[model samples]
Target: MPPLSRPPRETRALFRNAGAALPTRHAALLERCVERRLRGPAQVLSGHHNTNHVLRLGLLPAVLVGAVPFARLKYRVPRETVEVVPRIWPREWDVLRVVCRFLPEVPRCLAVLGDNHSLHVYRGGTVLSDRGPHGRIGEGLMRQFAAFFARTAGIPAGELPPLPEDWPADGDSDGFLRRLVRFTEERVHRPHRPRFGTLFDAVGIPEDAMARFLRGLHPLTPRPFALLHTDVHRANVVVRRNRIAVIDWELALFGDPLHDLATHLVRMGYDKEEQARMTALWAEAMTRAGRAELTAALHDDLGAYLAFEYAQSVYPDVLRAALALPPHATADDFHAAAHRIGHALSRAREPLRLVDVPPEPHLIDALRHWHDAQNNPATPR
Candidate 1:
């Protein structure tokens, strides 16, 4: 069967609702700007947040149009003035602009719309996960990511602008752990009145023991601050030509770098063996770059951070499954995802315990010894 084409009216409406609200002259100007920047014709490819539309133009790919809402009621805003105006909403454009200036790998900026609106020529690379079946490419990409951040660390804190005032700093290890404890108490340890039925109950995690397990954990020490890609999950990374290209700077911040490393590990579904291999590679890269101290801290903090990361995913999954109601496919899908995450966590728990030793002198070597001992009866600790 032939595929259906998107209706022009529907496409126009989508663009309008997404806040382009452009005048004929302004629309012409935008087209000219796009033409000057891109080699071919531009077409709206997708829409999100009801405002941004992804427009594809030949080799340039889709440029994102970010729009800001105006409060004025009667008069239609003129578009001519809009093209030159600064973006009014979340100021990620400001940071993106700064990053692009500093890093050649980032997408180049085409133009700025009114406050809260702007245009960026898209990067024509596949998001890391969209790369072919995950294997060495993923591993190589991760090592590249570690190297990228290590380079960013050399930028003086005073030189880089502080993270936008709106972005949360909770991705920091200390804040993340503290938030996990609270989420555990409120969602898992309390009465079973969760937004979704508790995963703890489904997984047979006794409510009474949940609090004790969480309370027994200590906060990871905050490491030296550097520019952080706070959400370094699989989806946020792009792999092109076997090189890692990081994206989604929306949650970027200045904080402990280990949080980013931990987030990457958590998202990649790295089992114990894979985690150990990746950590060893990362350590080697950091050591070669003269950042061994930071790498050591990250290796030490991985287990504590993983536990907190797992807890964060649990309640949200449970809540979503409960709210959907009925034995429908969607509900089943949610339940299945929750179940998978629960099981993954259970499997991860043993390795996490082996790796969770506090970071003192010789702590990591000791944990490695302990893990080895558990694996082999003849291996003396």
Candidate 2:
């Protein structure tokens, strides 16, 4: 699809009519933002699921205008948009502020309007779209990315608000992996029926193996919580001047640094060889940065965590495809999508075994109970 363009007169009119609150101060910032734009023709940067109307101007690079409140705007003159949430704008602003102080690679903050939003100017560069060849560099880039996060994670949590109250408990390796595995068993495997041709069947998750596999696995625990960019995927990274520029801070939380690494590894779709290469580089970087012990355990924790992540994705993928269906879509549409995701999850399970990490003892016992219940007609409920 082509990049999106500015809204039509009617569209703008509709926005105005929709009663979006236009901040008085934002009006001045919007004017200044447009004034700072390059003289060349501007184009709308599309393909965003967020509520921002993103445009690339010749002089300014990228500008994002929030469509909801009508006046909130952010400038990405030097880089791409990472994330925007009004509630945590202060925290994000503080993070960017600190990062810019230490890292020259980050874009410069031009201005922040009110307490809720800001604008930044970044130098532009190429973004890797294809997933195959970039795998090697992507892995190294992720290590560099981890190093960047480790710096922030080292910050004393006592100085912050004890991490956000809603932050995922998985910041600890054990909790993170256990939740992932449990989510898979309860949400994906439990829903399967013989007649349905569920994901397990499609992806070939062996009915017999599921029990033993889950039983033998143990969650690896890592000490010390660090600042984590929880959503570090291929899409969130940009390659500029031989260095990787990480974006998307909305999912930033205080947690296990390896979780971020694992999330990137899984999302980037690196093969086994590539994964090992990346993990080694990441471990080296962490070790050099004085996080050797945590880095060592991360290698083991990643395996179980990945299984959990893959299984977790199954439900969301099926749900997303289902929600995309036309209102009149038949029951078969939902079933087909669910089956596809289930199979994908099953295939994902194979890789988890390859990691050579074991599951937690409680989880092993639970899997055994579940296994016996599946086979025994009179098994306890």
Candidate 3:
């Protein structure tokens, strides 16, 4: 075991031989996060970095370790896509403390580490992904599950009391939408442009169109806002023998409730039939829970929210696509990247009015150019 206060360089060398040690920096971060806890002894059950460094820390009755500041862009043909790399370690302790108070479905938080990491005690069940790709537990379970959150509906103003800091600080619907667009622009899109500028140009994601979409989406009927686990996908949902638990609070936000459902539908791998059924179930649950106002315009407005999801997703999707191609990428690698990026652009076509997506060959050339530039010794990045 590494010492708790070990310098990161020494820590990296200590774990250099370990299989779980990804890169020196990632290994040091992971070891440091674990060192703060499990003082006696610990095991790294699994390691992954989606939005954070996730390590399942034990074999049975496991606790998950999530450490922030890990790399993202770890992708493909049209099979799957990476959405927004959510804000890492976003006041999750405070958010989870609030969510567990109102929603019984959330997993209990075991510990909040000093380093902005969290330990989520395993809820002792399987995530829905284990069942199948679509991960259906039936509409009865869905409606029952949806109704469990009915209380989120009808909470009077100031009843739940805002977080010490609301994410956007402006609770209006328009501000919330604008904030999401800004998150994509500032955090995901702009940061990597210098390194991957050509890829951005080739994908031709319409920045002005995204801005226009946000403006157009603002005036629609506003839904009552509630706390949303904005990243509610199949993996985040744990289905136990008795109860269900939603994990991962880092991306939770206070926003239109319908956005939550839209996120779930997109991320949960639901088929079209299941999507409709689940939507009905969710709406009934919200309406019965006294959130009729929120669901009132969902029929007319759900498309916009779903569109926002895809639109915001484009930033991360493109970044990940470019990052997937290695410096010495083969023809096959470029071909796959073209397919993947093409799929993402096509998904956003209708919503963002991406009228002119470049052909596959141009996309391939752009990605190769960007990858080579990054790896070239003479290139000044």
> Per model, how many backbone clashes are there?
11, 18, 0
Off by over 4 Å in 1: 1-53, 57-90, 108-118, 132-139, 163-194, 197-214, 219-222, 319-341, 344-381
Residue 270's lDDT within candidate 1 is 70
What's the CA RMSD for each of the models?
15.3, 12.3, 10.2
For model 2, the local distance difference test gives 0.50
Error of 1 at 103 (Å): 2.9
In candidate 2, stretches whose alpha carbon ends up further than 4 angstroms from where it belongs are 1-42, 45-91, 108-118, 130-146, 149-162, 165-172, 176-219, 325-343, 348-381
Estimate the TM-score of every prediction: 0.58, 0.57, 0.71
- The TM-score that candidate 1 achieves is 0.58
Model 1 lDDT tens row, 1-110:
32222224444344422234455665556656545544533333321111334443322112223222111111011222111111222455555555655566765444
lDDT per residue for candidate 2 within 1-381, as digits (tens), equals: 423444444544533221123457654756565555524344433322322223333322222232322222334322232222112222454555455545556554444444444454433565554333344564456567657666665555554434455444633666644544554555455554342233233333445433545675685665566666666666666677667776645446566677667767777777788777777777777777787766756656777656655645544453344334454444565455445544445545554343322233322233334334445659773
Best by lDDT: 3
